[model samples]
Target chain A: MSADLSIVRGKQTLGQRILGFFSRSVVNIILIVVAIFWLIPSVGLFLSSLRTVGDSSSSGWWTIFLEPTRITLENYANLLSNPTITGSFWNTIVIAVPTTILVVLIGSLAGYAFAWMEFPGRDWLLIAVIVLLAVPIQVALIPLAQMFGAIGIFGSVLGVILFHIAFGLPFAIFLMRNFFMQIPSELLEAARLDGASDLRIFFTVVLPLGLPAVASLAIFQFLWTWNDMLVALLFSNSQSQPLTVAIQSQLRQFGANIDVLSTGAFISMIIPLIVFFAFQRYFVQALLAGSQR
Target chain B: MTQTVVTPAARETGRGDADRLSRRSRRRAILIALAFLAPALVILGALVVYPIVYTLVRSLFDASGSTFVGPENYIEMFRRESTFTAIRNNVIWVIVAPVACTVLGLVFAVLMDKIRWSTAFKLIIFMPMAISMLAAGVIFRMMFQESPQLGVVNAGVVAVHDIFVDEAAYPGANIRPDSGFAKISGAIVSDDAVNDGSTVDVPLIGIRADSLPDDVVNAQTAAPARAGEITGTVWLDFVRGGGGVNGVIDSSEAGLEGIRVEAVDNAGNVVASATTDAEGRYTITDLEPGEYVIALPPSNFDQGYQGVSWLGEAFITGVIILSYVWIWAGFAMIMIASGLSAIDRSLQEAARMDGANEWQVFRRITAPLLSPVIVVVFVTLIINVLKIFDLVYVIPPGVSKPAANVIAVEMWTVSFGGGNDQGLGSALALLLLLLVLPSMIINVRRFREERSR
Candidate 1:
């Protein structure tokens, strides 16, 4: 895309080039300023996490540059010492992993069916998936909570994981089905000529071809489940609540325990940031897929 | 003659075999699709579909789920103060947050052009999109703290303020009963200023002993003012635990040391000004005073910067919205930036060549091109903030949570956050769903449009 954008500039005169240079420089400067503006708050949180609660409360995080000696991992140490928070940190992993795995796994199979198979009621079913894409999770919260309670998975990590995957499937299937449609029908015909069974074809041809979309879907679902607060809050027991819920529970109105907040927030933030940077292209690809909640 | 070669019965048999084959394939396909979709659909049905249907039905019933109440819960939802406040805040959020975010996103997206590290620049700007709204909420709440010692913003407010004006000498200081002064409106004034060559004992009380500045000592009467001048003592007249006299500064009494004394004339103009020293003493030398009110000015009672109450009723919604904007603007920016990247550059170049400034090119060519993505981002944010449970629930302290509630948060609160009225909660949830439905529909339509294109 940028290659095409760069190609738009051609056969420029000296004056035009110079004017363009200045304009480009101005754009660079503006973008740099906006980037800095955006980075400062998170940087502040990071810096605060490195300092004592007392030091953090007394002065701005920006001042840490002048007093570099004040930085410590005391907050992180304190967070590790607390059982509830550390428990929830582990619970975050327990919840997010299965949800991501199941969504991608189940979504791809369903996506292949919708995209490739000449099944009855296919178009109407696809439309159903599309319409379901817009159903706000708020509409489902109360009754699901009630239903979960009735069936006794209400406060369990399984309940939370199941809830995330359910809500997560529409977009996953949507993305996967769309991506799968791009594969040519000739490939499927070639496989069928050799008398390949449907499951056999799905496992061999469809799943392998669907990896890029699957990767995108996995990260999207993982991040959603990892960063989730509402579902975890509603469904998880105190013991099973994820890090986000834990961090939220620790927030105080006054005399905010900044140490816990800064450290716990950092702890909760680590996985998503790691996954984002690790799978940057996939993340953006999935974002462009634009079925995210 | 060629058509008469086959019998009608044979033709019917052949046609029946083909029909059976297609039917068998169709059934097989349906079975495969069911296998693939059944898990996702089952969970979706149990968690998403069934719950949605149940909420609609549940909302028509009473809290216990036994009685059919028929819209009473909907009326009751609005009648409750917290739920009503939540609706009001949701309306404000729906209007303000999306526009603010989309505009910011558009500006950032447009401005990101022609830069070499534009990608890196956007990576940083879009970084917050990776952050959980819960974390973002905590960050902003800390930033908007009310105390200069705590909140970065109020600290900034104090830092900027301290640059222009000096802080108060004695916060929460006031005049005592036995002092030769009485409180007049806010400022303390003496009946008469001392004549030249006389010492005025302007004793003070009511200040805490420990609150006195460390440099302060026992009050001592000053030597008589030189001719045409006045000198006085403004010591704390009362001693700790009742040891000193009320009218005069005893040896044990610490000075009411930091009071600002102003001598006001008949015209209410300050004739002289002095701040008391460590010994609770001040001298206005070279005073040609026939009469003056020796006033303790209001500066003495100054209660240094009490930072804004961020969670207070007036600004809680704004603070919550600000946090919402913080977390989401990055999302809007990244999506819009991608859209910007895909825009046809020649149109913009053409506009530029035709005497268009950057703004004009953006307005005429770039903006209209980017409007589709911008509207999608806007409507997406509208859908997001409508179900804005996390930030509102997490950001505001418990005390301010009610005032900062959105409909989603209200639904949670009524059912589970201690209100214990699931029926009202179901109604509130339905209201949020209805409120969000239009934007959701718009978003879905936009998605379909994008796909179709």
Candidate 2:
């Protein structure tokens, strides 16, 4: 009887194992299918960019497998030779780099003050920062356009950068201050006891400890400025338009110029994609930390 | 060393010196902090705070900022049909996009654990987060083209359609002039009724010779009709060399196969029907000895399966919203997955060991535990969608732009997209701010709660 019971128990375990395997495979299949679905749009764009103009217009991008010779670098070559697209590529760097650096410098100082220093109405100012975090960029667009016009910087790269800095600060300061608060007060007091000035303490102690947050913020701000189109559309002129505005202008009314559009769009996308992958850890960290708070 | 014996006056004097020194240091510290914060404060005060106040003031004034409108722009914004359409589209976006992204994200996050290649899957889904809204707009715009040859979406739709439904053989075929037939309501009908045992011919024009289906054979003349039967031939009337006579089925002309021919009586009922063969000859036999109309139905001339017009006015907003959801669902997934990782595993294991299946454990344990994160994702998405502009701006064609308009686009259009009505634009901007304010408040409150903990 005991032997019979053992055999039955073994059979039951085997059946459960098979059931588990089946369910697990189902989950994997679902996830894989979903991932492919997510990838099709971008993949389609990439393939379309590689095909010659005549070929892409006549058939879907997926047909390249049937005629592999149809793919070529001609579109990329044409895109590079186009002065407008290349100029806008340069314009993107001109706008994004300064915007990132200025936001970080100014935001770190303000965040340090808010976190470590004792000043009048500190809490009220921090509350103001929090409130500003929720304010959309549209509220600032009309008035700033006027302000930039009055200052004679309208439709210039400088105007776009300044706008980005102003809007990027509140969230930057909030994020940095929160990160800075986690640093023990003892460290700052130690530096102070050694006759370090407030500036020296901030530079040596606070900034070093806040590297993760700073890195995250830098990546976040860089991508934000690089990917921005609406601000550039409203504020920048044809002479100063970034790759996004340039691409938008090229989008024809009927029958898209697939060659110019696909190539230019891919060009605009490649840099951010590289930056994102290289520092994806920090990017994801920033996203997770930003949302949790 | 000198002996120390302090008088009360000396001690009090020392205390005063120390107090004065500390007060001066306090003053200096305030100045230093101000110095650190000055640039950020100036920019924020000028750009964010001041602009908000300026927009409010501008909304109350005329477009040129010289005359006081006093809420006239607001009233005008409400009265405009475009404004109502924009508001309605925004409501649809808020209702649809966020829920779609969040639910898909949750399901993806939960199922990812079951796969060995979960990281690869996550990366693929998260890849779009790096793409700019403008690039995504361009990608989707091309993907949703109306023609199957140009758009992958339509290509797939057309392929699937062809599988279940027979395509029309001749889309643009029509009757030759004076061919004893006239197009009535898109059908080729005989101009005069014919009795049984008579022969009829429908020689069609308008189809190019090169465009004809490859299997088409040379037209064959129908044999003389037997008693109580009607016979006919439907073939391309025009010859390739341009020497064939009008309304006559020449020997060289190719037959238009699969064209349906019906014998209709006076009451318009289809009495008998036949489909043309490769030689374009169809015959109806055993008909009563009475007059009947030989007609070709409209199905024979249908432009077969043009696929969906995805960029048309009806589907424009939906396509744009689908693109938005595509870009954002990964963000939601990553966030919720992080929250999922933080939950205690033993609770889930305990539920599983207690005879619950995966769905039960998910519904009873995982979903309930993940609610806080889910709510955060949902509200964040709500805030994001309210100001959505790029996809709406780029994906729609010029004709469908009005249908896909949201409040943000409306604001831009009124002020900058050639309308030049800044007063009304400011009002629209303020309206958007008000719509987004509630979700932002919820997010800020959640931040505060998280911080206090």
Please tell me which predicted candidate would have the highest DockQ against the true structure.
2
Q: Write the per-residue lDDT of candidate 2 for residues A50-160, one digit (tens) a residue.
A: 998888777889998898877899999989998999999999999999999999889999999999999999987987787777677888889999899999999999999
Error at B395, model 1, angstroms: 1.3
- Docking level of model 1: medium
Best by TM-score: 2
Each model's TM-score, in the order given? 0.83, 0.87
> Candidate 1's residue-wise lDDT over B266-383, tens digit each?
7888777777777778887656646666788776766666667887778888988887777777788888988987987778777876879877887788888888788778767877
Which pairs of residues clash in candidate 1, taking residues 3 or more apart in a chain or in different chains? Answer: B236-B256
- State the DockQ of every prediction: 0.59, 0.60
What lDDT, from 0 to 1, does candidate 2 have? Answer: 0.87
Model 2: per-residue Cα lDDT over B1-453, one tens digit each:
112333467457778556556766887899999999999999999889999999999999888778998999999997998999999999999999999999999989988977889888888888888889999999999899998988889988988987787544576778888767899998999999999999998988888665566667898988888987888888888877689888777778887778889999888788999888889888988788889999999988776787999999999999999999899999999999999999998788778768898889999999999999889888778878988999998999898999999999999999998889999999999998888788767766776787699
- Model 2: CA > 4 A from native: A1-12, A253-256, A291-293, B1-14, B172-193, B196-299
How many clashes does each candidate structure show, in the order listed? 1, 0
